[model samples]
Target: MRRVLALAACASATVYFEETFDSGIGERWQTSEWKDPMGAWVWTSGEWYTNEAKAKGMQASEDMRFHAISAKLDAPASTVDKELVVQFTVKHEKKDYAFCGGGYIKLLPGEVDPKAFGGDTPYAIMFGPDLCGYDISRIHVIFENKGENLLKSDEIKLDYSDKDEFTHLYTLHLKPDGSYEVFFDQKSKASGKLEDDWAFPSKEIKDPAISKPSDWVDTKRIPDPAAVKPEGYDDIPAEIPDPEAEQPEDWDAEEDGEWEPPMIDNPDYKGEWKAPMIDNPDYKGEWVHPMIPNADYAPDTYAKYPDLTTLGFELWTVNAGSIFDNILVTDDKAYADKMAADTWAIIKEGEKEAKDAWKKANKDDDDDDDADVDDDEEEEEEEELKDEL
Candidate 1:
């Protein structure tokens, strides 16, 4: 929590879009009916209290429905040769229901109707935290190219450290060098060249005119041909009758069945012998497909979006009440970092105290029971507020 207001004077960065949702949110943002019946989006501090009104965010106010909302940027953001940074914060207030939901946002390119933005709307990039069931937890970093949304081949796994109800930041930094980095709560989580983790076109491809030799021996090991099994090894039985069994003196032979010894594993029984494995003398190394210069190979220019005009969220959450705030899209990493410090870092401690106070005020008198509202009841209370459009 640097709480750094010192870096506010820097003007080298270009901020295409920024919002704290402190006030005037609905005037700049719009909702979509992409799902016909969509979840409600509210601007509040949720059930908990916050000392700073800026901490109040865009919350998915309902449960078990889709939510799509977007806002036009002050100007179109272009990633021609400069670094692009997308950062936002989220809080999953429902502890038990945080497992199945999404808190990610997207950057749209070209003309987009903010009111009509939905899952089908084309976007340049998407970045944020997402959890579905116990197995799927990750900070999604997806980019759209050639009409397909490309996901990282190697996933970004999320764990207990990143999953919490407290406010936390998610950031994605994409550079012009085909490199990118992902951060969680201001700490680096993953970084690599885009092509290494994405489905970018390769510079070369396997030659279609050539193949590995048919006689190539790829086996690394083989059984020893000279090894022989010992004579009469199969004579030993796997099991034998118990040698210590004895009949009780009071047992009645006429009324009861004859006593039988329990079978046991034979101590001296030898198992079937196997030849020792050795390195294959004639084996060639594993065949690698011959590669050639592919005519289809091209530099990944799709990474750059020249006309990105909107920033928004379009996701489905089984459990709502996740808050999103401090949305930022900038051309400088230093600027975004400073903004984060001045906002989330400074207000986090006070927010925590306020949240605790609110919880205490709402605690049950019995003490043994939790006062939190039941999620199922809330789900039933939530219904689509149909759009007039």
Candidate 2:
């Protein structure tokens, strides 16, 4: 019989890993650390081995390379409404690589299949430092909730440049819906919507008690952890919900004078822009973004027509040189045209009505003025007469 552990509702699920069974290095934990340090990313690889027989799980291997720990957790498939927080510490000896160590949580169906490792359909959360400087190897979250099945990728950069003694906290808040809200430390960084139709299994149970992979080895029948109330954890009250959760208020022109493109909502243009392709013969490399006086049109504004420089211009991806006159530049004219016309279209429509209203109000004020007895008007009329003289 397999021993099971039940998770409390709307609370932190704490499981202790005994150091005697498998330690961090001895467990051979897998991560993105196997590739060339210079290449894109390396996947760290290892397995968990336990000494206890009854306390063991269904998925244990003997590739010893970790610190001793007994209980290793497999995240529940659909823990929506549950904030899954993982706190751990990493010690680095070298500060040269800066982005030397990084890891990602594989929130998917099975052990990452090489065939689906970098495929467009996988789910993951990444954390680490970048090689380049300025103290920034923060955590980044990636998913494929939208876009081409292959290009389903997104990132959230964190600030973890100081590799000194630090306790890292990664929180995955499962929304009421199947989507997710990821936070580094306590700061919420990114939120993504999960498609309603995507097939997400509720649980994956691997019984460490069974050894033989025979036809009778039931992979589907994972015994649920018996219902036991969690102890030692503070039943803390929930914080008040933030209505504008991830929105940056200062990005608005009326609120903040600084330039921030991704924070703009309901922009003037509503057309999708694409990068320059071979389809257009006049495809010169003229997708440069122009400078703006107001800088309000800095991000998300397209470049000149056919110069769709803003093709991949996401809020998180726009840069300094890319923002032209408060507009994001593109490499294609069609994209630029759509952005310029759409944005100005809103202002133009409003301006026409505002101008007409202003003219009508001025005429009414002039007609209703106390023309025969107003000293202020008489003084203005005398001044006009003096100027004429």
Candidate 3:
């Protein structure tokens, strides 16, 4: 043991371990205080410690005061099956059982708030000195969700000395192939493979396969390995037919196809709306019409029309069959009433007005003709006077 200690110390002296805090500002280490029948202690922040020379500087307070708690390192989340090394030292504060146990190291999910959280799915490695004769050590892990305790708290009796306040190391090893072994003082204490060597209590249990025994001991009862069914029973049924398969029997003919064009049932649609040839009932513009009937005559022939070259207005098929220049109106009341009375009446009225304007213009043209005739008559009179002279 002396040579072993020296070798361990030398190996540890070669390597260094350190703790890193990645939390942001105002969020450093936090501790929780709790008191129960087991006693009172504070839970601190998660830390990583390794057996190295640097750990000498990182040692817990050597002062004869409060006992420093040890972290679980990497314990099993399901069955304490993972390899883990728990390290802690005992102290003599008042010399009267100052430190109780080394406390416990729990494998927690990386930083989650408990109040906002619901389930307690953490795994742990726990060891507290027993008030009874021997010191107790346990790799406590849980596989079930929201459970309060480990699935198989198989308390393994650790072979250790009791009198002195010494530092002890417990290494729990779990192989990649699902085999587990526990080592105390650098020596293997237990060994067993997972599914084959040990069996679970039930095939459908949430607890892992670690809840089995390697071989039956004299005192303990090693029950028969849990039963496992054949491969296909694990999955859902694959042969069931779909209820929504496409079929004429399930189809509703009345609801199918293009909604029957809402036109057949609606009475408001009077087949065709013969556009009234009169001013629109909704028209609020000046009403104008052409003197000559031209199907191609545009309403804006008399007024300034929009620049069709710059505007994209060619999309419309002009219904240019109406006889009128565009009617301009400030109110729709007269136009709507007149249009409703007789579609052709509005155009007749505009035609009358155009004829009157034309008659007046022709009368002016006749007056102009007479003025030219008078000039010729005046010249003839001048010539007669000249001859008489």
The per-candidate count of clashes, in order, stands at: 0, 68, 10
- lDDT value, residue 357 of candidate 2: 48
Q: So what's the TM-score on candidate 3?
A: 0.29
lDDT of 2: 0.29
Candidate 2's C-alpha runs over 4 A off are 1-76, 79-88, 96-101, 111-131, 146-155, 160-167, 178-180, 187-389
**Model 1 weakest 10-residue run by lDDT:** 380-389
Write the residue-wise lDDT of candidate 2 on 53-78 in tens digits. 21111111111121111112232332
- lDDT of every model, 2 decimals: 0.79, 0.29, 0.28
Scored by TM-score, the top model is 1
Q: lDDT tens digits, residues 1-389, model 1?
A: 11212235466777878888877466778988777788888878778756557578888878888898898887777777778889988888774422588889999998888767888888989889887644567888998888889998888887644555778888899898889999988889999888778887787889999888999999999999988887887888999998987778877878877877789999998676788899999999899999998675555584788888988999888887888888888878888888789777865666567777877787778852434445344333331211210
Per-residue lDDT of model 3, residues 1-389, tens digit only = 00111122223211111121112111222222211111112221112112212112112222222221222212112222222222222211111122232222333433433222212323322322222212333433222232334343355444333322222333344443455554433355566643322223222333332433434232332223443444444343433344444455545666774322221233222333233243333433432332333343322221111111100000010111101111111112222223222222222233334444444555666497786686578657545643553
Order of quality (lDDT): 1, 2, 3
Error of 1 at 201 (Å): 2.1
